[model samples]
Target chain A: MNIRVADDLTHAVGCIDVTHVSISLGEEAEAFEAVSDLSFAVTPGEFVCILGPSGCGKSTLLGAVAGHLKIGGGQLTVDGKPVLGPSPDRGIVFQQHTLFPWKRVRDNVAFGPKMRGVGKQERRRAADQILQLVGLSGFEHFYPSQLSGGMQQRVEIARVLINRPRVLLMDEPFGALDAQTRNMMQEVLLDIWTEIPTTTVFVTHDIDEALFLADRIVVMSARPGRIVEDLRLPFARPRVSDLVTDVEFVRLKRHVRGLLRQPEKAPQLARLDPLGVQEA
Target chain B: MKVIRCLIRGCSVLSCVALWQLASSLHANLGVITFRNVPPPTEVVESALALLKSPKLLAHVGSSLWRVFAGYGAAAVAGVAFGFAIGRSRAAGDLLLPPLELLRPIPAVAWIPLSILIFPSSELSMIFITFIGALFPIILNTIHGVANVDRRLVASARSLGGTSTAILFEVVLPAAAPSIVTGLAIGMGTSWFCLVTAEMISGQFGIGYYTWEAYTLQNYADIIVGMLIIGVLGMGSSWLLTTFGQALMPWRRAVETR
Candidate 1:
């Protein structure tokens, strides 16, 4: 399907192709501005992490890239086309169990293509492929509530990945997991990224997670959030915990901690104006 | 294990009846309230068996069943359709629900006089009264059920490209099925209670009419038999509906999906 040209908002004057985009939701509130003109981009097949504290509009920015939120004041485009709304080209896995409870796990995975009116056999084949990829092949007939939280989220990932989007948007997909499960999920994610090498942007609060999975880590200040620093992955692909002990990884981790300690709000105009603050 | 449970249940029920019969026998000579207006256990059994042999009695039972089913079916279909329209559309619900609520509280029997004047025949009036009895419950429950389906699911469906018809059929209807069944069961039970009053007042050939006909003839035994039959039929229909719902809602029970 053709990506329709959408009505331009205030953010739409001139911009290049955007890979990783940022957004703010504080304008909805009366007092504090939740997010600011926070922006970044990743090259094709790049893995990026967005790390911030509890309420840093992390999910909001993910939504902006998913074409789910309005661009407030910054333009975000992928492949030279503006995102009017969510598409099969961009798959998202929410933190919560967004699986349709009425649908079985396999059907949930099949939903994206089924909605696109794909034939039954093709969608089923794709769904089964992703289910195996996520290690949920035997769970095709199970409902969302029947599975454990971690298993449910795996189904969520399988559902999103079935369509093979150009970008994968995950908002703390593993935060709800237990520590052991979270580590396992990271390993699984790294493996999938290695296999597909799709453009993946993951939002999280864990400093180590941001360090471990990302090809580049983008740390943001609190409210009126801005990209404070962008740290490249010093480690190699299919990352393991061994890198957590690496000297470069330890140094990058400390720098991110230092940036988060600063208050959420600073000067929004000066932060991103005239060669914006590259590091907080 | 299930068969054993059923066997235990049957024995328990029989044991209770046997105990009741023994106690009544002990008091029968004393003649206080010992199975006087209340038929003794043996008499109830005999009444059922005797009625089974009688064409006139069985016909009354069949007619009463017919009246309840026909009235309840019409009311359920009309009520559910209107309920869905009103419940799914807030403005329509607001516009229609008030008048229905206002009319709901008025006894179906009170409408008997109005129904007679309005309809061409007493059967039509009886159907109207039974419909009145069943309609509000069906509509109210269906409205609640449809309205209360998970909004997130609906939103997700829209995002995933479900047409309005698909959304309604596949999502809203299944989500609301349990509540709708509950309404139908309750409504079916209550329809009998209402049908009796209609049959007594204006019905020519129903169990309720026969009960009154026996009362006028001073055949109190037949009156009691008719009452007992009415009670049994109502219970039987309701149990049938309950079983049907349980069958349809098996997955719901397992996963708590609704």
Candidate 2:
């Protein structure tokens, strides 16, 4: 399906070939702006994390990318096309685990391709493949309510991944998980991302989580949220969790923490500025 | 525990029958409240057995079942349809629901006079009364169900490439299934109620008509039999509906398990 161009806001000319390019939220009259002059891009197969304090509209930005929210300013494009509304190409994983409770696990995973008019046999095959990838092959017929929180989130991830989206947007998908499960899920997510290598925009509050999974971490500031620090990680792919204790990892973690603590308002004039903060 | 509970239930029913029999026996001797018109348990049981043997009893049951099912089926279809329209669309709700809201407060029994005049035949009038009786609960609960479906589900469905029609059928309908089932259960009950009332008020052959006719003929035993048959039918139908509802709601079974 062709991605239709959305009417531009007249404030800025649109950018091309960028996943999640400069989507802002809120009208000028709103009590407070949710996101302001927020600009970012995700290269194909790149894993980017948007880390911020709570209520900083990181999720909102992710929502815009997923086409669940309308951008009030600038534009968001995927593959050189503006996101007029929600499309199958941009899949979203909500923190609440929005698996259709009535459907069995496999059917939930198969829903996207079914909606996209794929034949039942093909979608079923795809669903089984993805469910196996998520380690939920044995749970094909279990309802969402019968699963644990962690298992349900796994099903949620599998459901989105089955769509083979251009960019997978996740809003703190492991925030509700226990510490151990969260670590495990982080690993599983990385494994899945590596296998498919779709462009992904993961929104999270945990600095360690951002540091662990992101090839590039965009640290956002609170209220009228804008990207404050855009740092690239040099950690090798298939990096182990033990790297959190690595000397360079520790130094970069501390540095990112310091940047987040600085309370620097994202200068609008310096827009398109990447902050260029890389940890060697 | 299961055996003990069953034994207790049996004892309870036995005691109720014994008390009823005792009350009937004492009525004439004590010169107290008129249990004189009420038949003893044995006489009622005999009448029930005789009625079961008779062809006329089957006709009464058949007619009542037909009226109840026809009215209730129409109510179910129309209620869910209108309910979804009202719940999902603002314009439909604004235009359609206000008059329904106004009419809703008037009892179904109260519509008997208007229904008789509106429909050409008494059978249609009786069905109409039952329709009115069943309509409200079904429509209201369905509206509540459709209106309260998790918004995030709709958003998620859209992101997954669901069109508006697909979202309604796949997401909204299933999410609202529990509430819709509750509505159907309640609608069955109200339909039975109004069916009996309409059957009693109007002419011919039904369990309700049988009971009312027995009253006029002073056949107290047959009256009790008719009442018992109606009770059994209502209980049986509602039980079936509840079982159907449970089958439709497998997700609820998981929630109920804990």
Candidate 3:
């Protein structure tokens, strides 16, 4: 895959325009294409969820967008600039809480600004503010190991948000938490997003989570992942947990599940036995 | 439970001492055992008390400590530095590790002859032996630690716009610290062993020298005192190393407690 930016193409003002992006992994001579011609656009302040079954390469796609992984083909641009490598302009949260185990919660949150050469006093204050925003007000001096899994995730979220990134890429940030904790984290995420909305591309395997959190759900096909459907969710903001019982939520879940259940779309998935990609 | 555990430990130590003292007394009276050289706890204590008054005891301790710290401190810094290079860089590992691996299996005691020839003084040779003993474990553990750092953590740091230097300082070093500390603790034990061995074989001063002198003089009680000093010192240094390691990593302590 190759990326070529033509002179005539205009930047979409404030958006993540992923144009036929593909990613390949493994050796040079026999590289396996994991994602293929996945095209989509995320408008400014839009919350988009990329949902797929395991081995679908949704995380790879997100990794490419975050500039953590190199795109093998096509162009991926954020607000017009091509994503060649990682920048503070885009922040990512992983399934595992990636806060530095050595750092205190406040220091972990302050890391991005610290890297960008922010002064000690200023970064600490900014970190405290973000920590408070993530509802971890009293956990400033606590190390990651002392906190529960849910609290660690909160620290991870605060770490990313403190950067004030234009695009927030989350690969199942709450996936490792318990069911109850996952629910609480989702609400907390929504509250934070409402307060300071950024263009978000959240990748997950959970259909209910996708439906609940996304402005648009981008469902991907299996191996050699491509876009299967891009359904717009019309759920109003300030959505409550009670909305899960709404008929529309269940209908959307069933539709996405049906799309995921089709085995014919990716026959190569069967060959991946014992080596299944951990999507969530 | 804690008090009971401590009491059990105290009793275990006392029992061993009591058994040794009884055997010594019985052997002295009946001549049942051929182990005449074995000093009783009383004799050892008396010898230790007598030795404590001699100024040479302080000199021996001071010299041994100086050599051990000089050699071990140098080894620790050099080992960690080389370990990071070999672990993180393929070129460095390929170029340097094979030779190190070949040299590592050779025991520190075996290097005494060559070290004596290479260095100007036996003092340096003794320190060299201690250095060799400490270096291998520290380097090997550090290499393992740095190489095994979680890829996800590095990736996350890179995504957060971390430079290579920043990532190394902030993520890789800290993540590898637990393993490095384990190596350091192991290295400290090995350092003491090699130091004593080297001192016994060829040394003008040290605890090992004092012990060797006592053996030549047929002062079995003084020999026992020397042995006990070495044992206590070895145990104490290792404990200090572990405590230092724990202080550096607050997260590991929390997890351990949990």
* Winner by lDDT: 3
Q: Cα deviation in Å at residue B69, candidate 1?
A: 2.9
Clashes of each: 2, 0, 0
Per-residue lDDT, model 1, residue B103, is 94
In model 1, state the lDDT of residue B177: 90
Question: Each prediction's TM-score against the native?
Answer: 0.81, 0.91, 0.92
Residue pairs in clash, model 3: none
lDDT of each: 0.76, 0.83, 0.86
| Candidate 1 residue A148 C-alpha distance from true site, Å | 2.1
Docking class of 1: incorrect
Predicted structure with the largest TM-score when compared to the true one: 3
Off by over 4 Å in 2: A2-31, A262-280, B28-33
Question: Could you tell me the lDDT of residue A62 within candidate 2?
Answer: 71
Cα RMSD, each candidate: 6.8, 6.4, 4.2
**Model 2 residue B79 lDDT?**
98
Candidate 2 per-residue C-alpha lDDT over B1-258 given as tens digits, one digit per residue, 9 for 90 to 100: 999999999999999999889888776554555677778999899998998898998899999999988899999999999999999999999998999999999989999888989999999999898899999999999999999998888888988889999999999999988999999989888888888888889849988899999999998899889888889999999999989888887877877784
Instruction: Please tell me how candidate 2 rates in CAPRI terms.
Output: acceptable
Q: When only chain A is evaluated, what TM-score does every model earn? A: 0.83, 0.84, 0.89
In candidate 3, what are the lDDT values of residues B188-224, reduced to their tens digit?
9999999999999999889999999899999999999
